[model samples]
Target: MYRKEFFVFEQGRPVSALIRNYERKDFPELIRIQQECFPPPFPSELWWNREQLDNHVSLFSEGALCVEVNGEIAGSMTGLLIDFHLDSPDHTWEEVTSNGYITNHNPNGNTLYVVDISISPSFRKLGLGKWLMSAMYDLVIYKGLTRLLGGGRMPGYYKYAHKMTPEEYIASLLDGQLKDPVITFLLHCGRTPIRAVANYLEDKDSCNYGTLMEWKNPFHQ
Candidate 1:
């Protein structure tokens, strides 16, 4: 997969990139970006490996996307459709993703499951994350899904973990003065926290808890 180099400098820094469907050749860069977004003690197993990522891209090519900035993969996002009943029981990341292959992806499902959305460390604060999330919304509407459902990491909970339960932490973040960098941004995108999903991953930063977030397509009904 050969890519032509292109650069656009603004104030001594590269500009935000465009989001596009994931390519087979971007897997290596995607793996690297995952490493940079997450640090040590956060088991590598928590992330999608080469084979798993390849499987995801193969199964749902349109759902997998990469952000290219200065000819580099600066961020990426992956998703799949699933059948979910809001009144039914809770779900774990594993149950929905089948450990990341998304083998359970239902083509006629009503919900869009966002498997992962990450940005390169160097590309932080570039609004790339927001762009990727917005793209997910576009996908749901385009595919005519009823809603979007997925785990939202409580990255800011690490600092408050010892003092607060996952529920309380998220409650504070949503209702109180607490502002979580990730959760807040997702909420701003029209997704609401549905519940606390336990053991979403080995993320110490999020206290191993993830919020079940949802966004209904207003245009659906």
Candidate 2:
């Protein structure tokens, strides 16, 4: 699979960039980049307006972060901790979901979900994505929101997978597609793909999307 690079610039100073908390003011720039990347990106007005942001800021505080290139909004990532039930009830799923770069959302349990991750076209392959994700890993661990989980598209789930075995069908259905570049970069850092969800959000090509991933911050474990 292919991966993109990332970078960071602060006050014209070159420095390593990592994932940080999302600010209410970043809505405009974030939505702009979202349009450039995602086919159906979130609306800018949703984040730009203070009223809407006030309601959504808490969901992003744990795993959301952005990159700044020369005082410009180069890229951003958003994640959340939702309650999910993989096997039983009362298990709070902690994950991030729905963002251009990385979607981190946990449906119902304490499991952390990395929904999406992306780098801007102009700033690809600069190590910025990796750095941000590394930081997110730290934050998630520090907060003690372990039991990580996520999903991605697997090649087998595409139109060409008709010949796959029954077992292969199961795996492909769970392992949808590879994470976005930045998310993949994070996986390289330490996150591990655990299980595959039954249903998937297919892409434009009608291929299954999102293979779940998990990670142990070691510091906590």
Candidate 3:
């Protein structure tokens, strides 16, 4: 764990924490945190099931990230690298598998994508989210990927952010909610929304989601 210290003059206090890259061994812990935060988070076993992940999708590696305050998992984030040029229909696992056929719509650009990010309830309000974003941004840039893409729901919190509560929030977000806050947050760290598409899955209960955002690292931009 790497430690950093900062002084808050307004609060008249000193703050500290350990920030580090996650490992495959951390998947179980990551699942635990996700269960605590997301309504229908993925199970711990799924992280190790590459065969279960859609071929078009890439799973997070051991190098994701974790933030600890005094030695506990306060937050974690996951990212993936995808061929942005591929226009493959991004659908849920059940939807595509049920069809018995996978379609490919490769669009033609290379980009790094952020798949998930979360902070434990106790760690909210701190700069932990921003910390994860900054770390992911740097990691993506380090790989020399020209663009970064990812999306989630609006308003931030899943329950209040959407018409549906936790279930809707999770479905919309993980299942492709494609809201503006996702674009806004990416932009805050230097990203831009480029296009929108309908929900990749035709599931009746799935929220419509189809916005693809891009952020060229300023250095690359």
Best by lDDT: 1
Residue-wise lDDT of candidate 2 within 50-136, one digit each (tens)?
A: 443333465445555677665666676545565545563211122233432223433344545554555676676565666666656
Error of 3 at 104 (Å): 13
Per-residue CA lDDT of model 1 for 1-221, tens digit only, reads 11223334556776645678877788888888888887775678766688888887788887887878866789898889888887873777777888888888788888999888888888775667777777788888888889888888889999988888988988897786799988988987778988887888667789888999998888998
TM-score between candidate 2 and the true structure: 0.63
Ranking by TM-score: 1, 2, 3
Which pairs clash in model 1?
A: none
**Model 2 RMSD vs true structure:** 7.4
For 109-146, candidate 3 gives per-residue lDDT tens digits of 35666555678876676767777777766766676677
lDDT of each: 0.81, 0.51, 0.52
TM-score of every model? 0.86, 0.63, 0.61
- State in Å the error of residue 161, model 3: 13
Cα deviation of 168 in candidate 1 (Å)? 3.0
